[model samples]
Target: MEKKAVYPGSFDPFTNGHMDIVRKASAIFDRVYIVMAVNSEKRRAFDCRRMQEAMERALADSGIRNCEVSIYDGLIAEYTKHHGIGYMVRGLRNNMDYNYEENIAEVNKLIDPSLEYVYFRADNVAVSSSMVKELRHYGQDVSSYVPPAIAALLADGNTER
Candidate 1:
C-alpha cells in the first residue's frame, strides 16, 4: 500500500509557488500526482495539454521525480479514488483560499470520507493562476512566479517592454 497524494489545479502556468507545494507534499507522500484539472465548466486561459506540458517541464527541470502530471476532467475525489490515492495537497495562500478549500473539502468528504487533505502555506510569496494570467495579459514578465519553461512561453507572447 503505497502512499499517494494528488495536487490538482488548472496550473495555467506552473509557478514556483505551485512547485513549492508539490515539493512539500512529495516529502510526505510516496507519489505526488500534479493533476492539471480540466474542468469543462470553467473558461480558463490555457488548455489542459499546455498546462500539463508546463507542469511536466517544470517538474523535470526542478529534478522532481516523485511527482508526475496528469489530466482530470470529472470530479477530483473520483480521480483520487480511481488512482487509489488517499491524500490531496492544496496550497493555502490566504484566508480566502482556506475558506474555498474548506468548502470543497466538505463536499469531497461526502464523496470519499477516507480521503485526507494536506495544506501548506506558500513557501515564498503567494502566487495564483489568476494572477499569472493577469500578468501575462498585460505582457509583463512572470519569471519570478512561473517556472523557466513557462517563463519562456510567456516571454514569447509578451509585447510590452
Candidate 2:
C-alpha cells in the first residue's frame, strides 16, 4: 500500500518555500498531491491551467518525482475524504501562519477526526507566495523567491506587476 498526502494551497504563484514543503513531503510519503484550491476570495494572475503548467514545469526542473498537481473546488477535508488522502500537508512560515492554520486544522479535525495535519517549517521565512506576488506587483525582482518557471509567469503577467 502506498501512503498518499495532499498539500492543498491556492498556489496563485508557486514559491520556493512552497517547493521546499513539497520536496520534504515527497520524501515522507509515497505520493504527494499538490492541490490548487479554488477560492473566490483570492484572485490569481494566472488561470488554473497556467498555474498547473507552471507548477509541473517547476517540479520537473527541480527533479521532484512522485508528486502530482490538480485543482479542487470545495472544502479540503471533503476533497481529501473523496480522494482517500489521509494526511494534509501544510507549510508554516511564522507564528501568524500557525495561528491561522491551527484554526483551520481544528475545524477540519472536527469535521473529520481521521484527517491528520502535517506541518512543515519553511526553510526561508521571506520566501512566500504572497511576498513573491507583492514583489511582482511592485515591479521588483522576485526570481530568487520562486522557481524560474513561476518567476517568468509572474513577470509576464500585467496584473502582478
On TM-score, the leading prediction is 2
RMSD of each: 2.9, 1.8
lDDT of each: 0.83, 0.86
Q: Candidate 2: worst 10 consecutive residues by lDDT? A: 152-161
Please give each candidate's TM-score: 0.91, 0.92
Q: Tell me model 2's lDDT, rounded to 2 decimals.
A: 0.86
Best by lDDT: 2
Error of 2 at 155 (Å): 3.0
| Predicted candidate 1 versus true structure: per-residue lDDT over 1-161, tens digit per residue | 78999999877767888989988998888999988887778776665676677678878888889998988788999998888889989998788989999999999988888999999998765577778888867887778888887776666544222
- RMSD to the native, candidate 2? 1.8
